[model samples]
Target: MQSFRERLQAFNKCVCDGARLMVGQGDYGTYVAHIAKTHPDQAPMTEREFFRNRENARFGVGNSSGFRCC
Candidate 1:
């Protein structure tokens, strides 16, 4: 059985993740885990690179299509 402290920590983590999702923020931890699981041979991007890439992808930055989502 899990101790109270352990259970509380886990619940807190879930709440935090849910909050981030509700705010449309990507979780860096989830990205890292996905890369590790699906692309074991490739290194995951640094957090800064990940966020920059996500932002560019979201807003169509540096794309010739010339469309911005926001």
Candidate 2:
């Protein structure tokens, strides 16, 4: 089984790629707002804000190992 770090890395990569595509497709604002609402901690941010938050490592993507309501 993959470790938490591995899972987090995969998730982050996917999100990053998705965000980039959205921005390139001219849906930056929409994508950012949608992610902010759906996944607040992983919400899209400006490049500056992204670097600042990333440097601080201050965000959570929720605990995915456990089951939740459907």
Candidate 3:
């Protein structure tokens, strides 16, 4: 049986995960934790770098330069 605090934390995490899914922004913490767990000897990127890398990887570019018809 989980304690009240533990249950509440789980519920909160579920809600947050759902909200992130709806908004299309992923949970960075999960990725960070994964890196820490799977590659204990490697250093993880800072939060800003993580998000920038994710954006670039997903979109292939950071800005609208490629979309310009000029």
Candidate 3, residue 56: Cα displacement in angstroms equals 0.9
Model 3 has an lDDT value of 0.76
Q: What order do you get sorting by TM-score, best first?
A: 1, 3, 2
Instruction: List, residue by residue over 24-47, the lDDT tens digit for candidate 1.
Output: 457898999999999999999999
**lDDT of all predictions:** 0.84, 0.60, 0.76
Error of 1 at 40 (Å): 2.4
Report lDDT (Cα) of residue 41, candidate 3: 95
TM-score of 1: 0.65
Candidate 1: residue pairs that collide: none
Error of 1 at 35 (Å): 0.8
The Cα RMSD of model 1 versus the native structure comes to: 2.8
> Which has the greatest lDDT?
1
TM-score, candidate number 2: 0.34
Off by over 4 Å in 1: 55-70
Give the per-residue lDDT of model 2 (tens digit) for 1-70.
9999999999997788777555432334565778889998884777566555443432322435443322
